[model samples]
Every structure is written in structure tokens, then in C-alpha cells.
Target: MSGVLVIAEHRQGELREATLEALGAALELAPQTGRQVVTAVLADDPQALAGPLMGRTHGLRLMAHPDLTAFNPEMYLPVLEDAIAAAEPGLILMPHSSQGMDLAPALAGRLGLPLVTDCIGLTYQDGALTAQRQVYGGKVSETLVLKPASMYVCTLQGGAFEAPETSAVDTAGEEITLTELSPAHARRFVEYVAGALEDVDIAAADILVSVGRGIGGPENVPLAEELADALGATVSCSRPVADVGWLPKSRQVGTSGKTVRPKVYLALGISGAFQHQAGMKNSGTIIAVNKDPRAPIFAVAHYGLVADLFEVLPKLKDKLAG
Candidate 1:
């Protein structure tokens, strides 16, 4: 069997946490399928790769090229497609970020392979690889299996896998080989538009307190902010909050907003809409406070409180303060 390949995602020389998570998922699949796990990095500077990936995986391969300096789909697609052809990997794992969403399907189309997007879980049974993915806005989980094709590409949802710990491998001695290829298409990145809060990223926060429509109106956002302050966590909002301008789009969390895997996620007055929960279902410990017990958030929450946020939040904050 061919080995499993994990595509390393980096920007400006920094490795994204999702890459390690994908590596961990790939490692889990490797033992079951009896295939070696290899990580392929596409970057200009090969020396900037970090984390315990070197010692943990079976091998590491780097594809360095000047064209990869900026993320260009036309340029990246051909390079990744060529790498896939050369490696003939049984499974190709990628982070389900914006870039992955754009490139995975195109690559699959080019290679004539089946592609799965936003996979939350992966397992093997009866010698077949199965993936658990959310459908209908996360209202349902569908299991999918791949055929005999050697190439299977999937984008993993953020926070789906636990971050792997670094091993004692001599990364300094590891040598990376580069592949040079010319892009068939030409497109240039004009400029990058920065978000309002450049330094504040909700995805990287450890604790998040998010608000939803159940909070009433934009006037009630202060209550959520107060709760966030009490917990020493960042404040985010559901899609409705952003759509109504109660919160900035930068602080939105859901399928349309930023996907987060915080250590502790407190959903106050959020009814657990599928679009909203898709972004936060991977939180380490989820606590949802809603008056509607039938709210879908409870399905994935570790702790649920069926009560009015107006009454419960202030008291909870007071108790925490005392």
C-alpha cells in the first residue's frame, strides 16, 4: 500500500497548528492501513518547518519553489498535482481552511480522484476508509467511503484532531528535497486586505464566550462581554450577531465566520444553529446556556444549562467574582 501524505500548510515561514492536527490524524490512519505517513511542505524556505513532525512521521518531504512564496491556486494546483502523481499516496490529508477548500477540489478534479471536504472524523472498517462529515449545515453526520483509487483527498475541520506532541527526532539532520516545476497558469496576488483586528484572532483563543440571537438584541451584547471579562476570555458572536451588526464580522464564529477550537467554549443564549455549531463543535469543553432544552447545541455540549441568560449570566459572574 502506498503511504499517507499530509500536506503541510504554512504562511510566512510559520507552520499552522492545523497541519500538526492533520499529521496526527494521518498517523492514526497509517497504523490501520499499514502505510507510512509522509508530510509534504510547499514553501520557499525549507528550513522554517517546526513542531515534532520530523520524529513523529515516517518521513518528511519538502517542495520548495519561488512561485509558492504567495498562495496562488493556479500555481499551487499544478505543483501539488505533480507531487501527488509522483508519490501516489493512498490518502492525502489537508487542513480544511479557505486555501484547502479552494485547492483540494481543483486538485481532485485534475487527478480524477474522489474528494471529501470538511471531514470531522476518519476510520477504517472492512478494509475501507470511512470519513464522518457534517451535512445540511451540521444537522446530520454522513459516513462516506472511498473506492480503490490510490489517491483520496480530504480536508479536515479545525480542532477535529488533537495536536500531536513532538518526538525526540534529530530534526537538524533531516534533509529536505525540492521539486521544481513551471506553472501552466499565471495569476498574481494584487494585495491582501487586513481585517479590523489584525492582532486578535478568535481561532487562536483558549477561551471564548459567544452570543447568539437568544441574547435578545445588540443592546444585550454588553452582558456577553461582561461574562467574557469574568472568564478572562475573548468575546465572539454568532452569524446573526454579525449580520445584524451587533458585532463585527471578525468576532463571528460559525461556518461563515472563523472556526475555533478553544479550550473552553461558553455559548450563552446561542440556540446551537448548525452553521454556528459547525465552527465550535470541536471545542475541548462546551457549555451551552439556553432556555430551549431542545436546542441542537446540547447534542455536542459537555454541559448544558436550560435557563434564561439574563438571569443566569449575572449570577454566574457574581459567584465567580466572589
Candidate 2:
């Protein structure tokens, strides 16, 4: 009857946002399942990576080994399997990123455990864990539950959960190091390639003014830019904008694009599709402007304005300028 185990992911000597978000998901599930939250990080410097997550978990397991510095499924599988064996967690959580996508399935297969991938929602009910997954590119939702298994593995969708705030806790994390793991020579460490060419990371932006197909055409993209300028924010868009050559692929925000956690997200003309929401749902404030009153974006949006972007943008720009 122990707690959940979150497999933390790090890159370039820093913990990724998905790691904290997975912790957030674990924190939410803990109350329902009545289990403590334990996080496991496999890295060269586990102590440095585990610093920020100190009070956040009931225990922090650092599987530090030189071979784990880089992300390779060949090296990660055995190390993670060892960590899971020691933890014996009821549930294991991994981020649904490139690393998790490669690692989770193989790890689950190796351990003969049931795994649910790209889960948007997770809850404990009837003494079983239920996960919600979006099918058909966020059009349909299916709930999955595993039975007769002592342990379960789940991959949390990016930006699906909020990052937990730092709180001072009296409890200190218990760190354990595993020395038995050795590098799997099947794959060798290679150089890391940058995903975006731009220096500005949309994922790191605090305020983002995003547009979708509702902006009518590519010409209206400048209006979103103007609004972003006035608000001292960055301009981002949905996949359609980038698809039509209106914006660069780097500015696209969705399941296939960069996941952002901006402080204020102004989504204009976006239909609030699940794919788009998957990237920005964790924003501190989501102000959605769409003519359709029934748009799904409003469900997660903190503020909603039912109106045309043509009229709303000018007024917003004028007000902000004044």
C-alpha cells in the first residue's frame, strides 16, 4: 500500500518541466489513493537534480551512475527496472515525451506490467486506477483501467497537469544511490541536437498571445503580433497557422508543438481543440476569445469572451496602448 513512483527526466543537466508536471499528477492522485509520492531520478548528478524536488516527495531515489548522463533506452531500461524493484511502487508515472515514449513501453514490457500511454486524466476509484486517453487526435476520450496487476505504469501527457508550487515541509527526502548498474554497450552516447533554432523558447515564456484558424487568414497574424507587442508577450499559434506558412513551426503550440506554461495565455479565434489545449492548459491564466459559446477551450480557460477577433483585437490593442 505504498505510493506512486515518478520517473524524473533531465536534459542538459536540468530537470524538464514534464518531470514537475508528473509530480503534480502524483500529488493529485495521492489524496484519492492514500499513498505517498516518491520520485526517482536517473542522472549523473542526481543530488543536483533532486534539489528542487526535495520537499515535494515522500522519498527521492537517486539512481546516479555515469552511464545515465544521457538518455538512451538501452541504458535507461535496466537502471529504471532496478529502481522500480527497490521502490516496489503500486503505480509508476513517466512523462509522455521523447524519452518516456521510448522508455516506458519497453520497461513495462520487460516487467510484464500493464501500461497506459498519453493519459490526460488519472484518478483512483473503486480501488483501481483509471486513466483517460484522447483518441483520434484529441477527438474521442477513452478511459482505461488495469486489473489483477500489482503495479501499473502510465505516461502523463505533456502540459496535462499543473506544476506544483514549492512549499516548506518538515520532511526531508531520503536519497538512495544504486551502484550495481553498468552501461549497456549496445548503444553509445551521441551528441544532442537542438529542437528549435530560435533563442527564445516559447515554453519558457510567461505571457503568450496565441492565435488559431479563427483569425480568418494569414493577414490577421499581425494583429496577434501587435497585441503581443502591446502586452510585452510573445506571439504563438496553432498548427493550422504554421501549416499555411503564416507562422514558423517554432511558434506552434499543441501536442506536436512546444508545450507552454505561460502566466497569461490569450487564445484568439482558437476552437479550443484538445490538441491545442494540451499545450496551454497549465497556463496561470487562459483568456479565450472565440465567437462560439460552446468551444471546448472555455472549459479550461479562466476567462472567456464571446466575440469576433476582428473587433476584439483592435479594442484590446487600443486599450493596452492607451
Best by TM-score: 1
Estimated TM-score per prediction? 0.77, 0.73
lDDT of each: 0.79, 0.83
lDDT of 2 by residue, 211-282 (tens): 998888888788888888888899998988878978888999988788899999999988877768878888
**Candidate 2 has what TM-score?**
0.73
lDDT assessment of candidate 1: 0.79
Please report how far candidate 1 places residue 161 from its true position, in Å. 1.4
- Give lDDT: candidate 1, residue 91: 85
**Model 2 RMSD vs true structure:** 4.7
Specify the poorest-scoring 10-residue window by lDDT in model 1: 168-177
